[model samples]
Target: MLTTSQILKKVKELEIKSKRLTRHLFTGEYHSAFKGRGMSFKEVREYTAGDDIRFIDWNVSARFNHPFSKLFEEERELTMMLLADISASSLFGTVLARKKDMVTEIGAVLGFSAISNNDKVGSVLFSEDIEKYIPPKKGRDHGLYIVRELLTREGKKKGTDISRALRYLNNTTRQKCIVFVLSDFLDPGFADALRVAGKKHDVIGIKVYDPMDMQLPDAGVLEIEDAESGQVARIDTSDYLVRKAHQDAFFRHSEWCKQVFTRAGCDLLHISTKEDYVKVLQKFFIGRT
Candidate 1:
């Protein structure tokens, strides 16, 4: 556990770095990627030569004896909700940093980016249950608070119940908003809840993982414990069958996740600990454009 001072120092460092990254390719792309509620009328102006005929205000044009057109702008203010999984499994990582650490950094970046675009940000940090819920609000302080919670809040329970988290989100959020679900996705049976949320909001799932999650390293015989369940097992990493089985299980779970998101018409991003998640997110934003 981090001390209060250490946590605050780390949070400050994260905010600096994340804001720098966001100012680069992130914030602008983020703004373009996720659209607003709808276009709103700004004002009526004199119609130009190339103005669309549909936008010409006949009543105003007739009153003024001139061609007038209604101009509008996109309603860009939005709320971005982050559903972060803080389960014990997220603390397991064999390369680079733990899954939790990566999730925190990415979450910070997203939060800062949203606030930069004049959007509100909120979070639901969950383990076996929801640990904390930060209501959506706009401001630098709110973004900082969300990042601090992401770094300092520890899971009281060990397991991951993504379904419960999604249900909570549905119950609390009444209107449409942008929802970003960040997790290692160690738990199953969340397809139904995810589907319902997808119907009302722009849902995106980010599967954060370590290299070991997919393939076990060749370190001979080893004792491994399930981070969530506390079940221990001995396995021979030297055996080809053992390694293949480990990879096969990961593949099956990944497939299920992909299918669920696809069926729900949601977007999914796969990020390994070894990869640069910031770049991946920027690329995704450009792709959306």
Candidate 2:
């Protein structure tokens, strides 16, 4: 647990870092990647030389006895929701930071990027249940609040229930939104809910993981404990077959997750605690463009 002052300092650091990253790297990509609802009619005005003839309002022109052009504006404001998993599994990491910490940083960056693009930023923190939901709102203060919450939040339940989180998001929001689901994806049974949510909204899956989670290091005998469920097991990492099985299991799980998102017609990004997530995110943004 972090003290209030410590938390505040970390929050401030994240704010600065997020804002800087948003301004320098993400603003344009973020703005272009996700589109708003649609164009809306703003007003009617006399047709100009460069105005599109398609926009010429025939009825208005006939009424006013002139060439009137309908002016439309892109409904540029978007709602970006971050569904973050804060389960006990997120606390385990062998690299630079825990999965939870990386998720918080990434969430902060996304929030700041959304706010920079004049979009509403919100978050749903979940474990086995919804830990907290901050309704979508605009402004820097709101983004900061989200960063702080992401930093200090502790899960009430040890396990992950992504389906519950998705269902909550689907029922609560009436409008379509850009939803980023961040998790290590240790749990199962969320494919249906994810597909349903994807059909209605722009869904992106961010799998934050540790390198150790992918494969076991040759450390001879080791004791492993399940973070979500307090189950423990002893295994010989030095055994070739044991290591191969562990690696194969990890690969199967990762492949399964990819298939789930792919079938849902959603994009998924895999990031590890040892790698630069910013680069991964940048690649994703550019790829979308």
- Winning model by TM-score: 1
Q: lDDT of each prediction vs. the true structure?
A: 0.93, 0.94
Model 2, 1: alpha-carbon shift in Å?
1.5
- Model 1 residue 18 distance off true place after TM-score fit, in angstroms: 1.4
After superposing all C-alphas onto the true structure, candidate 1 shows an RMSD in angstroms of: 1.0
Candidate 2: where is the Cα deviation over 4 Å? 59-66
* Candidate 1 C-alpha error for residue 97, in Å: 0.8
How high is the lDDT of residue 257 in model 1? 94
lDDT of 2 by residue, 1-289 (tens): 8999999999999999999999999998998888878899999999989999999999999998999999998899999999999999989988799999999999999999999988998999999999999999999999999999999999989999999999999989999999999999998899999999999999999999898887889999999999999999999999989999988998899999999999999999999999998899998998888
* Model 1, global lDDT: 0.93
